[model samples]
Target chain A: MSDFTTWDILRNLLLAARWTVLLSLVSFIGGGIVGALLLFARTAKGKAGPAFVKTYVELFQGTPLLMQLFLAFFGLGLFGIDVPAWLAASVALILWSAAFLTEIWRGCVESIARGQWEASASLGMGYVQQMRHVVLPQALRIAVPPTVGFSVQVVKGTALTSIIGFVELSKAGTVVTNATFEPFKVYGLVALIYFCLCWPLSKSSQILERKLNVAHRNH
Target chain B: MNYTFDFGWLIEYWPVLLKGIGITVELTLVGGVLGVALGIACAWARALGPGWLRPVVAAYVELIRNTPFLIQLFFIFFGLPALGLRMSELQAANLAMVVNLGAYGCEIIRAGIQATPKGQFEAGASLGMSRLQTFWYVVLIPALQRIWPALSSQIVIVMLGSAAVSQIAAEDLTFAANFIQSRTFRAFESYFVATLIYLALAIALRQLLRGLGWTLFPKRTAR
Candidate 1:
């Protein structure tokens, strides 16, 4: 067995950090698109739409993402269609992210005062037109801080994909640790990589939260 | 194409699955209660403690908040043994759950505490209450009442996140489902059932917490 220096381990971890960043972006963007649809369905006035959205949210939010990953990866094989880890992890994280993003965005949309919706309706604006012209603009402002905040959650969540052998940051750490017999160095580097990835997002979320609060207060 | 899905394997393993569910609930409840206590303490320490200790509390919260729970679990279960502090997988997993929940709880509770109106503290002080007495009877209690909803939801999140402890082979619901799947080759069925069970537990826990909140914070009911 060969002992690796700090530079060697840091270099490998930084490389694995790329996959973590890629997975976070893929899941966040994919989840945002799907979540927007779900948010629309949730807010739209219809019999079946609300129930379907509720079930969708509960199904994803109620269960653990790790199990969802397992179901997507291993469970699909039972149906005789093998799924690559990339596809399975992407699909699962997207669904998981959508559930959360939909709820966050819905809260933002709903926080718009009742008077705004009524005024748009009084002007003969249709539902879609009203939402497009009046409601969403205000809601988007309220949504900014939470959306940025939840992104930190999305980044941390990509760690679960490692359990399914997708070879993102955490899995890469495991491989390096086993080979080098340096769990402390390997995992410490892993934590530092994660910290480097998450700290900015965390700090920015706080800053955005304060700025939004100030804006709300000023208005 | 024709396909068949069999769920008969569930019948043979129902007892085992039920036992796993029981263990899952036990772990979540134990972890949730202890975590809330720890969270409350951490929140209080950060909010009202000496100036020198503020950074210590902040660092603890941030370190746990930023890292994924899986690595934290590995450190406790796998890494601690190297330091001559051997713990069984279950003990280490349970300890890690409490610590993780405590960090999150601290942040949420601290927010609630900060949001408390200054008038309440003044009122308590005017009634000839000591600082300790005033904090307990006036600030901390009411602060908890206000943040109970957020606190309970965080506990539920901790409970759901507890599923990750299965990575260390904790014999929780997920671990049991994995075992049954390997033995019976009914991966989808086993996991589907596990998912449904988890959903039910989450809903049940939410309702339970809501009821507990109602009982604990009767004064808020009038509002």
Candidate 2:
């Protein structure tokens, strides 16, 4: 039997952390695009659009992500569509991220006052033009902090993908623990690596929130 | 390709599902109270308590918030035993859920605390309230009333998150699904039913928390 050193373990874990990074990136970016579509659908001038978006958000948000992964993995298999663990994990997280990102973007968009919309409409602007020229630009400012904060959540969300056999940092920790018989050291390093990934995002989110709230500070 | 669906397993496993729901409720209820309590304590230590303890509380909140609950669960369930601390799967899951929700709950509650007006403190002091009494009755309750909605949502998030605890063989709803799936080879059906139960639980829990919020903060909430 070959013995693994701490270096061997950390190196392997970092190797797996690469997947964690990749998965988070794919889900975040994919979710952003999908969330944008949901945002449009949500804000479009219709009764059905916003209601559908609400149900979409609630359906995704109300369920556990682990179950979502399982459903995507096993649910698809029932349709004779074989999916690797990573693919299923990505699809699930993307939907999960989209639901949250859509809601965040909706909140940001809704924070725009009615006057802006009315003014844009009074100028003969269509819905898209109003959103483009007036509402979204302002909403983007309020959106940045929470969006960045949610990225930390996205990164952390990747950790659960490990449950379905996607070998991210958490799964790597488990595998390394079995190999080295040192769970404390292995998982402590796991948590530390995550902290390194997330602390700066959280701190900057706080800083940005403070800066953004400067407008309200005077009141 | 053709496939037929069968829910016959569900009928046979009704008792298992109910047992799983019971365990899940137990986990959420325990985790919610303890977790929010931890949040209040941490929020206090950070906001208005001793200066020396601020950094420690900050680190605790950050550490728990950034890491995933699954890893935290693994760290406690698998990692802690190596350090001479051992616990059952239920105990470990409870601890992880508490710490995770506590970090989130701390941030939510602290926002409420920070938003309280400066004059409220003066009013309490003028009314002959000690610092302790003032903080408990004046600062704490009002802050809670303000943040109850956000806090209720956080509690529900943690409640949904309890579904992950079944990973450690904690015999929760998800664990029951896994068991039934293994026995019946109906993976999709099992998880679907289990996820539905979880969805129902989340919705019901949210409604219950909202009702609790209305009852608890009746004076603050206007009709």
Looking at candidate 2 chain B, the ten consecutive residues that score lowest on lDDT are B214-223
Query: Could you list the iRMS of every candidate?
Result: 1.9, 1.1
| lDDT score, candidate 2, position A152 | 96
List model 2 lDDT by residue over A74-117, tens digit each.
Answer: 97787788789999999999999999999999999998999999
Alpha-carbon DockQ of candidate 1:
0.60
Across residues B105-142, which tens digit of lDDT does each residue of candidate 1 receive? 99988988898788988898899998789878888877
User: In candidate 1, how many Å is residue B28 off?
Assistant: 1.0
TM-score of chain B of 1: 0.95
Instruction: Give the chain B TM-score for each candidate.
Output: 0.95, 0.97
- Candidate 1 wrongly placed segments (more than 4 Å): none
Regions more than 4 Å wrong, model 2 = B220-223
Candidate 2: TM-score of chain A is: 0.97
Weakest 10 consecutive residues of candidate 1 chain A by summed lDDT: A210-219
